[model samples]
Target: MASLNRIWGLIVKELLALLKDPRARVVLIAPPLVQLLVFGYAATFDVNDVRVGVLNRDGGELSRRLVAGFSGAPAFHVTRHLDQIRQARPLLGDKKVDMVLHIGPDFGAHLHRGRAARAQVLVDGRNSNTAAIISQYAGSIVAAFNREALGNGGDAELAIRAWFNPNLVSRWFIVPGLVGVLTLVVTTLVTALSVAREREAGTFNQLLVTPLRPPEILLGKALPAIFIGLAEASVIVAFAVFWFGVPLAGDLRLLYLGLLLFMLSTVGMGLLISSLCATQQQALLGAFLYIVPAIILSGFATPIANMPETVQDLTLLDPLRYCLVVVRGVFLKDLPLELLLPQLWPMALIGLVTLSAAGALFRSRLG
Candidate 1:
């Protein structure tokens, strides 16, 4: 009973110490909420409002109609009308225009003769993904125009459907992932600096004089960060669902289960970093070093399948990688326990190993 009381008092003390400062309270709460709003609205995959150039050598009615199609597309704005094809080359090179549609002199003749009309599209390949999306948008416009011109009463139409995110809004994908990342940034930094801050303030000896064992001390330090992490995560999740309209299709119980396990892994990793550092500056640097690579390899911004085979193999060790899959799956797909077990086991194993290692290190340091 006395040991339980001691652990409870230690936890309360750590929590009070962390929340006592006004700056610390703001730091803990504000950044994650701001990043949630900013990244959700701004970080997008849909390439809209692109500049396009038109070179109409034909200057015929059909050519004008096609030019109007490009101009009317929501994805494109026809910014320049070139008299000569040669004029577009300079704009393309300067990136003043993302694409140029060149209508041939014989384009109307080919259309009237029932021959396939041809248009050349020159795209800037600086950003290949954006260039490809531009091509698709242009192709869609041309295809719709062709269907209208032919009056295809019997032509088979293909209807494309997207699952999970039907509208393919990047917000639906990015906002949930930000929950894991923001929680990671906040929790890791808070826990990573916990030990170092105590040491720097000359409170290490004071802590040692207490009857609290090393594991109890570690728990007192680690639990508060985990609690703060969960609070930050809850705020992000609320904004994602209510403000951004990203639905939480999964069981709330399972989603919280994943969040708990994921935070355990993060807390353990942070404690390990804190145990190795002598000062708060080193702790901050250490957290950055771990976080940047973790975010990259976690397949948040890019698909892991697109990475090299060896790099894909390396991602298996990243707790963030699995946590992202869990959070996204729960948000979009309502993944079942059987489906999530593979990720959960790895996180549990990593938490146990890292926390055990950190506890031993702290004990040795105190000894």
Candidate 2:
């Protein structure tokens, strides 16, 4: 309790110092909002209308139907048709099309006989991940057509009914998650460079020789980032509610609490990175390396279930993944304590671990 009280005072002092620094104030408040809007809307993996190439050798009603279906949706796009099978290689190699669909000469005949009409989708193997997702998307479209064309419906093991977002708007999933994610980047990146800049400008040495303890100094350093992260979160919440029309399904208090815990780890990770790197360039690079992979792996772009078991287990150590889980749960699932415990504890545990590690590193770096 005493330690926390002291940390609180140090945080307050740091916050005051932050207010006095105009540059720091801008860093704290501006970039998170900007990045939230930019990356939240722009950097989406729910890629829509990816260019597709069609080799419709059949030219039958079923082929037209298949072509129309794939082209119709916002997800899969068909722009160019190949005259010959050999034309596919150049198109894919040039990145002109993501996938190539080949409708066989006997496509209509096969479906007419009550047999499964098969179409070969040749995907560029150079980029297998996109190819795999594209294949699954194409397969799903074809399956739906097959079910409709043949009038077949049966029991499936799992039935997915998306609540709140019946259409599964990428923005619904992304905007809420981006609240935490974009804030994490801006807060951490800004804070990570703070110390290095202080060091570069000869201010850090003066700071170290002061009466402040190492933990106090660390808290002071992290204090500004907290405000930034919280502020970013607020901006995104408003954006989600007003612009995107995503409902806030849970108590705002829980959302803020979750944000704070997650930010603790994020700020800690930033401090940890700052303490480790000697130069701002190294700090920026380190932060980028962490951010890119963390965002990609954190169930943001892909489901963690799709990853290999080893990789999924490794994500247990990633705080962003847990934060994303919490954001999604609170916003979409309206998850109570039962559903939240799994997500919250991991964030708290990681915050404890990473913050402690950062504190120790800060002490060493200062000493």
Candidate 3:
């Protein structure tokens, strides 16, 4: 009963320490929410409202029809129509448009004569991903035009269908993963700073002399951080669903279950960092160092499959990598328990290892 009272007192002290400062209170709540809003819109793969210029030497009906198609495309906005190839040079040079569509004089004649009509597309290659997407948009538009012109009589069509995200909205893919990323960041920062701050403030020895045991003290530090992390996760998840309209297709239980495991691992990681650092500055630096690489390797911004085989192999130990797949799966795919177990078990293992290591380090430092 005395130990239970001691644990309660420690927990209250930790919470009060976190809440008493107005700036810390605001810092704890505001940045994660703001980042969620900013990244949801800013980090995206879908390109729209692309500026395009058309130079049509063929003034015939077919040329006008082709130009009409460009104007009608949702991904493109026709910024200007040029009379000469030289006119496009100025537009391209001035960066007024991202792409130029040049239709030759023989474009209509070649089509009427049953010959393959040719057109040229000049694109800004500054951003390779954007360029690739634009190229695909142009190719699809051209292919569609050819099919419409050919009357769809005998040509085989590739019927492409996307599952999970039918419209292929990057937000659907990105926002779900933000739950993992943001939660991990906040949890790591809080837990990593806890022990370091206590030591720096000369409270570590004071706390050690109290009735609370080391395990109880560690629990006191960890429980508050876990609660805060879970709360942050809830906030981000709500924004993703309510504000952004990203669908939640799976069981809420499973989503929370995955979050619990992921948060545990993050809390363990944070505590491990905290036990290692003597000051808060070192803890902050250590957390930042871990976060940047963790996010990169987690397949948050890019596919893990694209990495070198050895790099991919290294990501196996990253809890966020598995957590991302779990979060995204729950949001978009309605992934079953059997599928999620693979991710959940790894996080559990990571949490156990990290938390145990942190406890050992904490004892050593105190000794």
Candidate 4:
């Protein structure tokens, strides 16, 4: 009972210490919100409004229709009409256009005689991903035109349907992952600073002199961060759904459960970092060292399958990786509890190991 009381008092003190400062309050609230907005709006994979030029040597009605097709696509804008192939060099080199569509003089004649007509797409490959997406859009436009012109004489059409995210909006992928990422950032920073702040202020010895055990002090430190992390996560989740228009397809309860487990693992890692550092600056640096790699390993921006085998093995220990699966799955896939168990248990295990390690390290430092 006394131990619990001591932990409660310490938790309250920690919260007050964090919330009472004007700068601390701003740091807690403003950065996460700003990052959320920035990442939500700016971080995207979908390409749009691609500027293109046309070199139509074929001066025929069918060739004009092909040019019209490119003009009509929402993804493409025909910015220039090239008189010769040499004109495309300056346009592409000067960054005036992303790609140029070149149709040969015999395009309509070949199509009219039921022979293959070839068109060339010259793309600026400086930004490879954007260039590839542009190529795909251009290919799709040509495919659509072929279907229309051939009147069912073309090759079999492939129907591509996106399941979870029907429109394949990048926000549907990014924002939910932000919930885990921003929560990890806030929680890790808060806890990582806790012991370091106390040591820097010369108050860590004061806590040691109290009747509170190491575990009690650790609990006191952890609970406040967990509370703050969960609150921040809730705000991000709400913004993801309400402000960003991302659908909440799964059970809210399950999502929160995953959040809780993820937070526990993150808090444990933070506490471990806090236990090792003696100054706030060192703690801050240490937190970032862990954070950058964690985000990279979490399969947030890139797919895990694409990583090299050794690097892939290393990601198994990253709690954020599991949390991302949980968050994205819950948001987009309507992931049930059973489906989430694999992700949840890894985080729980990571939490248990890291917390235990932190406790042992704290005790050793006390001696």
Candidate 5:
């Protein structure tokens, strides 16, 4: 009984000491509220709020009438009316526009003649996930509108084909991009805490006083996790291709190219996170806190178009989202290099900035 009492006393003392730490309290208590809100609202695949540009060459009452309905639909908002197709190109490039509705000049004539009129819908294939969803929604909306207007039988013949992922396999879309996400998870936490752990264990000062240069320390700490991330990526890709039956459509070279740049970005971001945090707990909590939104906002599991208007626009800041485009495009769509350069440059730019920032921070803080 005396020994039991002594053990319980020690346990209570440790608990009390833990509770006394302000940082522990903040890490444990603060995340739940933030995470609950993030997962609750943003974790979804159902896409909405398609920003549609209407190019109406047919200024007839029919064209005018249809434009109102497209805008009025809750799913689509008519952002602008472009005079020419060239005008819409910038919006697509900027990702300000989701889809364009070009009402050809013959639209009224065909409808009047009781023939099928073609309204070409051009999608910003840059964001194929959002592009895919928008394509489906726009087609359905237009067809339903056409049926109602034509007073045809209950339906029109719809033989829609999905180019990249015909099976609509979720993993085909998700697994390739999972490479980036897994890297973020491992790299972010590991790097975020690499320096911080040493500091918390009370070894940081000793290490700082060593002969090793700051860049060497940072690289030495970061390289292990970067290697692990790369291995994990290769395993996941192998599993996806051999086990899950996801075809590696594009050349392996492009896949590696995309993955390489992406990993550089992840490692750089991890190094940056590590330099900012002062302790392991802070590093861990901060990594988890940041990665949750980073994953959601990446459009890996959820389509960006589904997010609220404000949130969708802000997703551009996440490097993972752009990386996802490259992975999915290469692995599934086999998109050409010309097609992927738009995604490639922004991420490389971000990676460079992250590396430069981390180096500066380490020098500033450690020095």
Candidate 6:
């Protein structure tokens, strides 16, 4: 009972120390909100309003209809019409257009005889991902034109349907992942700084002289960060659903449960880093060093399946990876508890291992 009381008091002190400072309050609230807004709006995979130029050598009715098709797409904007093939060079080189659609003089000739017609699209490949998306959009436009002109005679029509995010909005994918990412950043930083801050302020020795055991002290440090992390995650989740229009398709209870395990893992990692560092600067640096790789490996921006086999194996240990699956699954798929168990157990195991390691390290430091 006394041990619990001591730990409870320490938790209160830690929370107050974090919340009492004006700058700390701002740091805790402002950056995550700002990052959420920035990443939500700015970072996206969906390409829109692509600038394009047209170079038409074939003065045929079919070619004109093809140009009209490009003009009508919401994703594309016809910025320039080139009289010569050479004109496309300057436009593409000057970055004035993403792609130049060239209609060959033989385009109408081949179509009239039921032969295959090829239209060249000179795309700026500087941004490979964007270029690929643009190519797909352009190809889709061409395919539509063929269907209209040929009356379904050219090729078999392909019906593509996107599930979950029917419109395939990139924000739907990004914002949910931000909940895990931003939460990890805040939780890790808060706990990573706790011990270092105490050592820097010359108060760590004062705690050591008290009756509190190492586990109690660690619990005191961890609980505050877990609370703060969950709070931060809640804020992001609210914004993701309410402000960003991302649907909350899963059970809120399941989402929070996953978040709790995720917070435990992150706080444990942070505490471990905190115990090793002698100063706040080292702690901050160390936290980021772990965070950067964790986020990369978490399948946040990139798919884990695309990674090399060795790297994929390495990601098994990243708690953020499992948390992302839980967050995104819950937000988009209405993931049931059974489906989430694989993701959940990994994080719980990681939390258990990291927390035990942190406790042992803290005791060794005390000795």
> Considering lDDT, which of the candidate structures 3 and 4 is the better prediction for this target?
4
Please provide, for model 5 over 1-367, each residue's C-alpha lDDT reduced to its tens digit, 9 standing for 90 to 100. 9999999999999888888989767777888887886676778766667788889998986677667767887889999889997887667645577777888787777777777777777765534566577778877777767766665332322233333555456667667777788877877777778878887888888867889887887778868887887788888889989998888888777767776777677778877877788877678778888898889888877767677767777778788888888777777667788888888777788778887889898788778
The TM-scores, one per candidate, come to 0.60, 0.59, 0.61, 0.61, 0.73, 0.62
By descending TM-score, how would the candidates be arranged? 5, 6, 4, 3, 1, 2
lDDT (CA) for every model shown?
Answer: 0.78, 0.73, 0.78, 0.81, 0.75, 0.80
- RMSD of every candidate to native, in Å, equals 15.0, 16.0, 15.4, 15.2, 4.9, 15.2
Model 2, span 37-120: residue lDDT tens = 435543444545578888888998877988888898777778898889889866764457767888779877777765666787
- Candidate 5 clashes between residue pairs 3 or more apart in a chain or in different chains: none
What residue runs in model 3 are displaced by over 4 Å at the alpha carbon?
1-157
TM-score of 5: 0.73
Worst 10 residues of 3 by lDDT: 152-161
Give the per-residue Cα lDDT of candidate 5 at 101.
82
Top model number, TM-score: 5
Residue-wise C-alpha lDDT for candidate 3, range 64-116, written one tens digit per residue: 87777778999899988888867765565334776788888887877776667
For model 1, the stretches where C-alpha displacement exceeds 4 angstroms are 1-158
In model 3, the clashing pairs are none
Per-residue lDDT tens digits of candidate 6, residues 190-221?
99999999988889988868899999999999
lDDT score at residue 151, model 2, on the 0-100 scale = 45
Residue 292 of model 5 has an lDDT of: 88
What would the per-residue lDDT of candidate 4 be over residues 1-367, giving only the tens digit for each residue?
9999999999999999989978568657865665564344434556666788898899897788888988999878899999988998668644577778888898887777777788888775433445557778877988888888665243312232233554557787788989999999999999999999999999988876789898998899999999999899999999999999998988999999999999999999999999988899778977876887788778787555445566678789999999988888788767788878989999999999999999998898775
Return the lDDT, model 5, position 353: 84
Q: What is the lDDT for 204 in model 4? A: 89
Per-residue error at 18 for model 2, in Å? Answer: 36
